[model samples]
Target chain A: MTDAAAPTRPIILEAALDAPPDLVWRALTEPELMARWLGASDIEAKVGRCFTVRPDGPVGEAPIACEVLEAEPGRMLSYRWRATAPGEAAALDTVVTWVLEPTAEGGTRLRLVHDGFPVVLQGAIRGQGAGVSTMSAVRRRQAPDLRRRGDGRAKMSSGEVIKWAA
Target chain B: MDLFDFDEAILEADILRALADPTRRAVFEQLARREMSVSELKAGFSVSQPAISQHLAALRGAGLVAERREGRFAYYRAEPQGLAPLIDWIDRYRAFWPERIDRLKDVLKDIKP
Candidate 1:
């Protein structure tokens, strides 16, 4: 809700689970446990292992593409979340981090961070584009205003004219 | 945020890619606060002037920045409205986690380890 805080603010979600850290870790890492809550995923905690997570049931968004960035048993897990579609150049690329802590009552306190406030969310996660093909179309649509200026100012400035894809 | 048009969606993707680099993101954030000429912006970073210009060019390409020429100097400033799509996108996603996590709590309570 606060934009003035930092350059890129990550989304943070927290949960206090009644289970212990090990049980919470199992739920976070085990495929079956994950399917029961999060999407279905591979349990291999090795860093750099890439996997796809499909929603447990038939109805949901497309499978999310992920690569493990770090893993600490019963403590933390982080992975890159890439949700791209066919024909898109490059789309949504965000990181999902799970941090677990043992509370005084022995329950597990978990923190989830999805970074990329402005850096990573793109058409990759939401949808796909034909890409590259639209540049000519954009130029054609913009010729009325940009070209009518008639001066080389557009060319002299910034090397190329840009539209908001508006 | 309806994003019915293909171009608009690509616009979001383009901006996302533009800001993906930490350095470039920093530059944009700096400009967002106030407009500055290339030299003024360059003083904040150790990269070569051309490297800074490249970053500015990328930011401009994505429509996240606007350049103003003041005599011999061109000043760059962030177009805050350009971030509307990103903020809107995040708003949509913000609702996702809590709902899912609530479900996760239920799952945790119902399931054995």
Candidate 2:
């Protein structure tokens, strides 16, 4: 899992499913079924609407506030994911998109991408060593000092953050 | 590497180009807060009316912003649909986390107190 480095570009992941495209589409758009796998109590997939996704076991924070960016029945869906609570480093909300194509074997080729990594990752790779231009130095260097600082300013726990950074 | 595997890259490039300009970025920031017309966008910044129009044109071309003609004025707002593909792509990785946690739970269960 790489931090999507490009501000405008998206990080893509693909999966080929044995199920038909229609079946996959239902699994994606149908909120009740999607919750079984994806978690969250209320999910409205319409464009311009808001949805809440509460994943179990604390991956980041609970109940991320999401705004529907786009949706095309049976083909594509996109939305913005952002932390709902305040006092967390104000981050540029990230975007996620999914595209489904019909494969030759009557299955679906699912393509997913999330764009807008925080500038800190790019700074880290560039050897800036300091945090992102926007983030506090403590947060920017949290990976190297996870054991020392477990104050929990970030949505993801230290272990979770380290695993994600890896 | 299959460079052309994702056309959303092309879409992203276009969005980036639209955002390259300072005025356009400010325009987007304004729209993020609330829908506004071309005149309203002009008011938010110190640029000339024609300059704001040019920025709006660029944003509209990128599909990052959409316009609707209401009476004599044109209203513009954030095109949330345009951003959907990017957001959904990121969430795909979230699926892997639970499995990893489950594995760690198993390891802990195996350990003696």
Best by TM-score: 1
Q: Mind giving the per-residue lDDT tens digits that candidate 2 earns over B64-112?
A: 6788897898999765444433333333334343333333233323331
lDDT of 2 at A27: 65
> What DockQ do the predictions score, one after another?
0.11, 0.03
The superposed Cα distance between candidate 1 and the true structure at residue B34, in angstroms, equals: 9.5
Give candidate 1 misplaced runs (Cα > 4 Å): A1-7, A55-60, A119-166, B1-9, B19-79
Q: What is candidate 1's TM-score against the reference? A: 0.57
Q: Model 1's CAPRI class?
A: incorrect
lDDT by residue for model 2 (A1-166), tens: 1223333434445555566666666666666655555555466668998887665543344355678899987788898865323433223356767788999987677666666543212322243322223123333332233332354222233133311222
**lDDT tens digits, residue span B3-62, model 1:** 123454566677776776767877876776668988899999989899999999999998
* Alpha-carbon lDDT, every model: 0.66, 0.54
Worst 10 residues of 1 chain A by lDDT: A157-166
Per model, the share of native interface contacts recovered reads: 0.21, 0.01
